[model samples]
Target: MGQARSQAEPVRDDSLLEGTIWTPLGSASFPAEQPLRQGHPPRTEALPERTATRTSRRCLAAALEAEKQWARAALGAIGDAVLTIDLRGTVTYMNRVAETLTGWSQREAIGAPLSRVFPLVDGKTHRTVITPGRRAIEENRTAGFALDCVLVRQDGSKLAIEDSAAPIHDREGRVTGAVIVFHDATRSQVTLERMAYLAQHDPLTGLPNRALLTERLSRALGLAQRHRHLVALLYLDLDAFKPINDAFGHAVGDSLLQAVASRVQECMRVIDTVCRQGGDEFVILLAEIRRPEDATRVAAKLLAVLGRPYCIHGHQLLVTLSIGISLYPDDADDADALMHNADTAMYHAKRNGRNGHHCFTAEMNTRPLQRRRTEPGLHHTLQPSQLVLDF
Candidate 1:
């Protein structure tokens, strides 16, 4: 009975502690109760801070790597050759285009001097420039001049190059190196020169056209005005050229005009310029003429040349020219006035006789002034005597 009472008392005490473990307000006890079956309810594991930090670092490194790859791809995609060199003239960077322009690969060109890799020459002299890189670096200026040079290829073939050089500068306003961009301008330059020549010259007769002739006449007049000298302007019209064109065809007419143009050029002095003013008309600018007789001599010489028959395309063409002379300052002041007076004088020569010469006079100006004021489209053949023909 004593042993049973002792066991019952211990059981009663355990029940009291269990009942107190959960209070009326559900407050927790001092020490957590461990389950008998499970070992301490498996203590919850917390994540380490170092592991999270390591994960974030890995993500940032991946982002940086992706950006670097994008930049490299962008640099490789450009068409123009890009080269970066140090101030000491050593090549530090070169793109794919650079490798293609110069036969040296980027691997071989890197760290090589620019002069040794791509040498340039003077255009006019064809001499190699010794220190182009040094000039760009020291001067801190850009330079661009025609350079006729040859590029040595990897396969030993030579490529002719016309290149322009420019200096590259840093953020500190100092020239770091130079970059040269060039292409084949051989065919293009020749085409341009031919076009320029054609613009200033007559395509048929190969003489100065109206535009160049006028420009030279203006300059000659200015010089004459300064030196108190006279300039002779002669206007010539082929009299029987139309008949030749009608009978023998346009090809014969063109041949006759070309022959006449050559003959007219031969009659004039070296200082004089003979210009074709389109369609059977020619103008001669006689520079530094002393007297009016000098112009008469030129007109006589032109008439003699044109009096001969031209044999073209198995046809003999005969043509005569009527010439009119006008003196600068004595006839008119400016280019327009001089040209108009000469034209009026030319018509007078044509009306007086088919083959003759007429000079501008003061009475010639009055008739044109009267015609301009009264009659707008009055077409009258002015005779040498009716309009002032004496200079």
Candidate 2:
């Protein structure tokens, strides 16, 4: 009777059997065969056709869901702000950084206009910076903004931002949307500006230094030549400056120098460039000089202004200036030569007497050759025989 029942009708299989599992879509078997436990379901081939199809579909749906979650995690992990816009410039997606940068949540930003979401402007001009997303999509390429771009956040605060946009292409090579990447640039921009300022200015007096003076002189020479004009350089030195520093403490002497710089600056036109050429000296470049005598007039005014008494640290002090003038194209063709000639004339003024001005002449260049003969270093190189003969 038991043999007849088993052969006559199909029954639930209680015994384990390993075989290929056939589903509606395709077949997938288990990794390995184990005993068919009594409470557990039978092998895959034992399942109904409809049930097999349902199980396969669920697995596919779960895989797609996991892939989407992974993509969202990747976008959130990026450091820079990121957003995506359609070809029509509508905001379609935003990462966590983008939401933070715009001060808008992802839900609030999606489906918004790109301009409304970004709200960028030129920091210097205060004019609206055109959104690069539309341009990138239209041109089917990438576009970027200058470092001066500023983004206005949702709360009305402004941030210095730099960004770029690239068009998204479909498999068919058609532009579909654009991706934008941006980050804060305020710190780097300020640091670069500060470094550039310190490079060209003096630490003590906040005036242009000699290196900057040379740069401006070259530019001024170009303009003067183009306009058929001449550039004049007035090199100035404080007469007996060392003795004053010796008489008083350096702190008081520094205050006196700072005061002198102010008065000297007050004696020039806005077109003039006054630069501090190290201790107790300054070089002034007068751009677009109509007459050589114009430099002489400016030098006289500066001497009068700088020679006034200065009260520093409650102590009265008196100082005088010696100025030497040289004209571009007349004194020398280049900036360095003009500076050297002016320096020579300043010493010539000192030799004649303190507190005066002198115009450079061709004979001033010969002073260096004369000085080399009497230079103190040359005395060190003299042989004992030469000294004995002199004795």
Superposed by TM-score, candidate 2 places the C-alpha of residue 81 at a distance from the truth, in angstroms, of: 10
> Which ranges in model 1 have alpha carbons more than 4 Å from their true place?
1-119, 123-160, 163-189, 367-391
RMSD of each: 17.0, 11.9
lDDT of 2 at 208: 93
* Tens digits of lDDT, candidate 2, 100-216: 889999999999998889998889998997877877888778999765889999999999888699999987999999999998787667879889989999888888998888889
Q: What is the lDDT of residue 147 in candidate 1?
A: 52
Best by TM-score: 1
The whole-model C-alpha lDDT of candidate 2 against the native structure comes to: 0.80
Q: What is the C-alpha lDDT of each candidate?
A: 0.71, 0.80
After superposition, candidate 2 runs with Cα above 4 Å error: 1-154, 163-187, 367-391
Model 1 local distance difference test score: 0.71
